[model samples]
Target: MLIEHLTMEEFAAGLERTRTVLVPFGSTEEHGSHLPLDTDTMQAIDVGRALARQRPIFIAPPVHYGVCRSTFDHPGTLSISTETLKALTIDIVAALYRQGLRYFILLSGHAGGTHMATLTDAGEVLLQRYPELRIAVVSEYQLAAESGRELIETAGDSHAGEIETSRIMHARPELVKGTAPAEYPAFPKGLLVRDKRRFWPGGVWGDPGKASAEKGARIEALVVRELRTLVEQLEAWQDS
Candidate 1:
């Protein structure tokens, strides 16, 4: 159920029966020319809602800002430091844990390297403080990358490419407009610090034109199925 819609008593009752909480985490970043800035957030909430339909869980409001330093140069990309993200995440977990929620599934839709690292580190700190709590943070795209590789024909599914575009098409078709032209800009082989704008000039890494609502539906189903397995794994740890 959506936590925001629940009254305090209802929420407490939900917590009493349901040990797991699903937190949709996303980013406000430029998603090429076709998709909207809230693409990640929309996709994340979709996943959370789908998962909640299959299991009894509290769906927390989505986290919209994330670590996007690489893409910050692109207009409309909102970013926060890794440390800030870590602290915010830890605080959120602590607050929820106080409500008797023992399991947290941070369903991230963003793929920033620092973002993922910060989430993992925050979960670690939460576990240290509350040894009884169990947390799992992961991205739906990463989970589908292994099995849905064939579905992606764009340069790559890293950014607002085929997979992401398709996901949006399936979730919210009216939001999509003309797509950015496909370009495969490569970065320096040995560069330690690279600029996303230089490597991906179009702000698009893959061919979004290749995306279709049919493919998007397929991808969404695949991600949800994989996430269900992950949630089950987390649930298994609740009583241990």
Candidate 2:
């Protein structure tokens, strides 16, 4: 069930049955020229809803705008500062912890550096503060890596690549463009450059030509399976 959709009394009643909550984290950024700006958010929500169906977990409203410093060069990309994202995550989880929800599963769809690091750090602090709290940060791609590589045609690039585009196709097909050009920028030949200006001139990192709804469905299925297993394990831990 979604916490945002429930009334105060209803939410409280549901919490009495299950302390586990799933929080979907994503970013609003340019997903190449094919996928929609909300592709990450849509995928996260779809996975969260699927996980909720298999277990009695409350689905918190998604943090749609996250830290995407790498993609800030792209137009229409809305990224928060790293510090802001960290503070927001800490505060939100702390609030839920006070409400007796000790188990938190953070579902991150965006793979940007700052967002992933902030999530891991904040989750670690929360777990340390509340020993009983089982806080886990799950990257859907990591969970579906093997399947994604085998199923997706373009698997190497990180941003707006086949995996992401396919996932978006499955989650929101209408938002995907039919004829979008794909480009794979050559890796830097010289020493690594720290400046965004030197690298990633087009605000994208991967080739999106091989994206398909079939691959997306396969990836989504794998993620759902892995997440369900984790949720079952958490339930067993709670019982023990």
Candidate 3:
């Protein structure tokens, strides 16, 4: 069930049954030229809803802002500071912690390294504060990347790539325009530049030409399965 849609009485009843909550995070950032800016958010919410069908958990309202460094100059990309994202995550989880929820899965659709790191840091902070808390910071992208490695046709498919495009195609086809040409950014390794878009003009990191709804459905199912397994393990955690 989604926490945002639950009434106080319904929330209380849910708490009596389960303390597990899945908090999905995504970015209001660009996803190449074809896909919607909220692609990450949409995919995260999709996974949460899919997982909920097979398990008992509350889905928190997704965090739509993330610290987007590479896509900062891209159109429709709205980024918050790294500190802000971290603090927001900590505050949200802290609020949930006080509400009798103990198990948390911080699932982010935006899998940027910095964004994931900030979430991991927040999970650590929550754990430090509430030792009984059972938390996991993860991204369905991690599972999709691993599980769909063989199914994907594109090399180094990451952002706005075959996999992501396919997932969006399966989940929200109406939001997609025609597919954009495959592109790989040439950002300087171990260096920072102000003109991020110049190095990656198209804002695509992999081939979108190979994306298909069939592949997307399979990948999404795989990710949901892996997440279910993760939740089962988290639920079995016992204080030592």
- Name the candidate that leads on TM-score: 3
Cα deviation at 239, candidate 2, in Å, is 14
| RMSD after CA superposition, every candidate | 1.9, 2.6, 1.0
What TM-score goes with each of the models?
0.94, 0.89, 0.98
- Quickly count the clashes in candidate 1: 0
The better-scoring model by TM-score among 2 and 3 is 3
For model 3, residues 1-240, the per-residue Cα lDDT tens digits are 899999999999999889999998999999999999999998899999999988788999999999898998999999999899989999999899899999999999999999999999888888889988999999878989988788988888889989999999999999889899999888888999999988989989899999999999999999998888888999998867
Clashes of each: 0, 0, 0
Which has the higher lDDT value, candidate number 1 or candidate number 3?
A: 3
> What is the C-alpha local distance difference test score of each model?
0.84, 0.78, 0.91
Q: Which residue ranges in model 2 land beyond 4 Å of their true spot?
A: 186-198, 237-240
Instruction: Name every residue pair that clashes in candidate 2.
Output: none
Output the worst ten-in-a-row residue range by lDDT, candidate 1: 187-196
lDDT of 2 by residue, 22-64 (tens): 8888899887667788877787789889988877888888998
Per-residue error for 124 in candidate 1, Å, reads 1.1
Scanning candidate 2 in windows of ten residues, the lowest lDDT window is 196-205
Residue clash pairs of candidate 1: none
